[model samples]
Target: MKSGEACLHRLVDKWLAPATVLSVRVVRSGRMPAQRARFVYIEAIAPSGSRGMFFFRHQDGCWRVFPPHDARPSLCVDALAA
Candidate 1:
């Protein structure tokens, strides 16, 4: 994994540990137009059978999980299809 991916790994370890990584599907990914950001979509399923799409942004050598303003969930699928 690259540094950007490493940041995501750290995030997984921070928030989603004590759980197993059942699967991860990279639905979409690309560089941001006119910006220092890269977007990635993840279709993740945990060992407990939970599923969701996580939207992440890699910008300026850091990945902070996207849409930090939302209180509902840190991840969703709409971004993956964007």
Candidate 2:
């Protein structure tokens, strides 16, 4: 968790000074064992006073940043394009 926090700060450093984590929420989808997937949702406030969100998935016994599309297939790629 610490490492992930550090990484998030670095990632937002260009646009925002640093990020202060506001909340961390863990969620699991599906009731069936075979369909279950765990994810961590992070809400943060940037030094510039803007809010941001980050999503990570449990894989290989560790949480890692996952693609937004993988996290939610409903999101449009065009809207998220840089």
Best by lDDT: 1
Q: What's the residue-level lDDT of 72 in candidate 2? A: 42
> Clashing residue pairs in candidate 2, if any?
none
Q: Deviation in angstroms for 45 in model 2?
A: 1.5
Write candidate 2's Cα lDDT for 1-82 as tens digits: 5554535434434333343644333333322243254543444454445454443434444433553223444777898896
Number of the top-ranking candidate, with TM-score as the measure: 1
Worst 10 residues of 2 by lDDT: 23-32
List ranges where model 1 is wrong by over 4 Å. 1-6, 15-20, 34-36, 47-50, 54-59, 67-82
Candidate 1 structure quality by residue, lDDT tens digits, 1-82? 4654647667655544445867666678776564536666655667677554454564345566663332243677898999
Q: Candidate 1: which pairs clash?
A: none
| Total backbone collisions for each predicted model | 0, 0
TM-score of predicted structure 2: 0.34
lDDT of each: 0.58, 0.42
